[model samples]
Target chain A: MSECCGTTATIEAPVEPRVAGRIRTVALVGPPNSGKSTLFNRLTGLRQKVANYPGVTVEQRVGRLNGIGRGDLTLIDLPGIYGLDSYSEDARVAVDVLHGEMPGTPAPDAILLVLDSLQLRRQLMLAAPVLNLGLPTLVLLNMSDLMEARGGRVDTLALAQELGVPVAKISATRGAGLDAITHFLNRKAEAEKPVPAEGRIELPVMGNPRSYRQWATGISTRTKYKAPLSNEWTKRIDGVLLHRIWGPLIFLVVVFAVFQVVFSIGQPLSDAFGEVLNAGGGRIGALLGHGWVESLLIDGVWRGVASVLVFLPQILLLFLFIGVLEDSGYLARAALIADRVMRSIGLNGKAFIPLLSAYACAVPAIMATRTIENKRDRFATILVAPFMTCSARLPIYMLMIAAFIPNTPLLGDFFGLRAAVMLSLYVLGFVAALGTAWLLKSSILKASSAPFILELPQYRLPTVRSLSLRLVDRGKVFLRQAGTVILAVTIVLWILSHIPFHADLAGSVIGRLGQLVEPVIKPLGFNWKIGIGLLTSVLAREVIVGTLGTLYGADPATQSLGLQAALRHDLTLGGAMALVVFFAFAMQCTSTIAIVRRETNSWRWPAVQFAYMSVLAYVAALATNQAILHFVH
Target chain B: MVAIALLSDFGVEEADELDLSGAWKLRQLSELPIGTVGVVESLDLPGEIQHHLMHMGFMPEARVMVVRRAPAGDPTVYSIDGFEVALRRDTAGAIRVREYEGQNTRQG
Candidate 1:
């Protein structure tokens, strides 16, 4: 009975007739680690759009199916879920979208269910619920290449009969056997006949996982599906990677290498990018001939944009390393290694990834918290993520350390006083994050207990296409920030500084506001100039470097000196130390604040977060400045 | 000691059973040594977590093997239904498993 109809005819005959343009949306759904994302990337290439679902942080990724010569078709990649039961927010959104009940998303006309063939017995459990939805579905057995290599066997024709759906074997990573997808869609295009009642398979009791599992097991047995032999490499690798001693030792080394690369390689690349932007701005400014328009466009707009844009290299590099770690399955191992430490701080091991990535930038790091299933744990992670000392804090820390700290050797030639201070600042930020997480977890956001259930995926080599796509996505997000919030803030600062049409630097509107703020920061040993930097840095943490550069450049006494020399001449040792300390603890970046608002979906959390961090920063800076002053005297 | 108590309790429940040779023992999943194989008997966790574990192929009668443990030795990895899942000791303690004699039980 299963072999009576050919695969092509069976798939084409069931799709319900809709108007030509109405058959536009197709949903791609699968359980986690089923190669669903790899398939999505293969199908969509560069035409994907990522956004959040209405009023929630769950990402909605839709792309044009142009790779298969179907530009008219849209593929909506739903979140990877175990079942359609609404136990989590991800499941709820997936359920809503599939039922066409989601507010803004179009209901999918068909479904592409990707399941890992190596684990087909367990994965087949999902097929029952999805097939019951009555949408035209194509069951794609992804990783079929690996399955075959490992001596796993599956009779697709028989399996298709058991599920009453079309089943195709394809390796998403290898980009092989994808023509079946195009064929299915092409037939779906010309499919005008209504689905026959006899085509439906007898599904298990809905919403019961035990019944689903039993039903799935029976199907696999009848279809003669053989489970693949466990991959030997994975077991051998885990022996060393998860060893009692060697695992943690290797994890530390990997983390240290990532930061070292970000500073050693990424910094020089950023400096070169900065120089190019500067030279381009110079040429454009010379064309305008030293007028207010030139200053507004070059110094005000271009400089501000360029300052933030220069960090793109470091950000992309960090994201590249993170993407590789994630794709190759090493990140999950790292999380496992870090689980005990995280649990002590009232967070799950999954929270470790976001906090680790927070060292790059807090925006994406906050977005990464969506993987943490517990709401309180997720929120607590987000609240402390910005304290991890992002790359944006590097410029101010370097400037302060270079000006204030002498190059005295601390550990022979291997470590010096300056390096020690830099390391201490990093440690300080991490300690603050841990402490804050503990407080939040123990206080209002406390839960009964958050369970940690992590699935460790088989290790695979990271693909070049996937890594490049990740870098491109991250680069786009960073550039968008530079173009929008940072650009607007720069333009506004320029306008304020030039309000009287030709006012002196000290007498401008922003300058007056800086003087007004000086009294509040006086206890922390900061002057009006540092006051201005602090105010502008609320828009972006690194803008302080640019603000200070402009302020000191306008001062005739320090105009000839480099920024480090000018900073040394103007600031006391205590004030300079206090400045970096303030940055280390404060939530200053507008981008971080905006992302927090979007992620938490309320102003209350970000508002409380900002106020608490600012208070902590103020007290810490005051204590640092006053202690240094007293000790020196 | 706790494993023995749990085994005796299960023995009372299966009093009518024919396999009275003491070849099978009931224990928490966490008590199983690395490379040991067992069948899931029940999950005593809370509602949401139990449902989630079941969805991840931890239903009763499924075969699960202890694969490895993390470096810090808290979350142990178990192979169930052709995939590896790591559960902390506390979560693992909530799962009851039936370990039969002559099964794979390699000592670590």
Candidate 2:
């Protein structure tokens, strides 16, 4: 169902008249790890995204699986939800899709209740409710392979008799029984005869009572077993990774290693991407003849959008590895270990994931904070999330670190000790996040946090196709967002810096404004050009690089290659450090701010977030400026 | 002596290995006879199962019956808060324990 994106269908508006009446669509809904995703993957083959994390799969994925030997079929994979009592957007989306709550999102024709046969009855806990929802449901008894491997068995015949639905058993991972499953779906899709699912589950006897007992009947007859489980590699790895003392230390070290890889390995890739963008633009510019048309094509759209995309590989590499760690389930153990430590600092252990995300981009990181229930804690989390020193800061970090922070002998002792300087920036970000969270709790969002609770899914292999598709989709969103806001701001800043200007480029209106502002920032050692770039960065951080690329009289595509040399030869020791401090504090991305407004459901907090973080940046940069001058000058 | 009628994510090396046979209230799954009965104060896990169970108002007072444990010792099926849920023994271990009586059991 998610595969339908970017298809360029050419079918008319609203899903086409020819396709609408005959279209057969089913949505797979279940709890995380009940194997809904595995079923979706199996059903759609490689034509979809697999969501294996809690609170991800924020949007419903649509994919089409047509001509199953009978007719066409379509499947939409809704987010992994807990229940109809939806709390988060992920859960709400699931409910909303089921009810056709959003415009143009038609209600699914049927629901496939994907259940882990090992936990068959609990799977029914979700299944029965959907049945109660009156949607015709087909319970796919998934993970049957696990049942066999573990020596557990399900009475499929009895269960089907009990639920009165045609049950199809399949092991979604190894792709067994898929043909039969698809055939059954094909039958349902093609046949006009209404085979309504039979169920209004009676709740089992319990101390608590609610009539009709949809919950109770599910409890009464189901069976499960106690089994010994041993996987040597996991135990061995968990030795250090989940160790009582060293676990968190190892997690920190692993996280730091990833950052080092992103910062260092990403450089050459970024350089290569710059060349491609430049060549592509220059050829197009020549063809079009340089004018506003050429400028819009080369500089306005292509160069502007491509510059942000050059960072994609870095962001992808980061998110890909993060996804793997999460899928492998090491993240849960890390969370458990970190919980003891993070809880002390007034943040939930779960906040660690979003905080880590802040390194790639704060927009999603802030959105990811929804998993935290305590409003105050969640807000505090969002407040500090920006400080995590995301990938946006990488170019700036690489430039400044290469220029000012010379490699210590300790760096050569290990891989990229230059990474340590960047690592310290992350630590600084955390400190700022916590400091601000503490301040916010005491002042404005001053309420206690709900206790953090989460179930850790067992480790499993993450499918690459789904993960990559997800990266492309997310990167597309990031590019789209960065392009729109940055283009408009870049032109505006260009006008601001270039107009009512002197004959020379440096004396342009934007330059004079920077010059006027440079004195205020001089304590922080910023020159007017740096000031202008910093000002332009608020619309988008990538723009700061472009602003520099343009201010240095080089287009971003061509100019990025010599940035290290340029900054190194040009910037004073204090000047480089001060620039780092400024980037560290500035409210650099507008998408992040927009997300904040939506998440908080008010403009007030986003406004406050901007003011407070900016003030923190200014003060921090000034102090760093004074300290660097004292030491080196 | 407490014999764990082990319904665990880990298979029992011996049958009825966990001595959980007792009338345990819903609050005592963690501390009851190592494994006779199961108590579910809350299904606070991350997924939809937890969400549904909570919506059914299954909380601190709901009693559960620790039904059969598979030979492989996974997904210990139990009746709780008027609903049945199967849990990996690893998840069950995370539950807090208390004392229980025989009549408190929903499943004989």
Give the best candidate by DockQ: 1
lDDT of 1 by residue, B2-89 (tens): 3333332312223324343376689999998888877687899887788889989887766688988888888999988778999999
What's the CA RMSD for each of the models?
A: 5.4, 8.2
Residues B75-101 of candidate 2 have per-residue lDDT tens digits of 343544222344445445545443444
Which ten-residue region of model 2 chain A has the weakest summed lDDT? A223-232
Choose the strongest candidate by TM-score: 1
lDDT of 2 by residue, A415-443 (tens): 46577888788777777877776676677
TM-score of each: 0.91, 0.73
TM-score of chain B of each: 0.76, 0.46
Classified by CAPRI criteria, candidate 1 counts as acceptable
Runs off by more than 4 Å, candidate 1: A1-22, A198-200, A367-375, A408-414, A556-569, A598-603, B1-22, B105-108
Model 2 spans with C-alpha error above 4 angstroms: A1-23, A41-58, A66-74, A86-93, A189-241, A245-253, A360-382, A391-427, A440-449, A491-509, A512-527, A539-577, A590-608, A623-633, B1-96, B99-108
Look at candidate 1 and tell me the lDDT of residue A448: 74
List the DockQ of the predictions in order.
0.46, 0.10
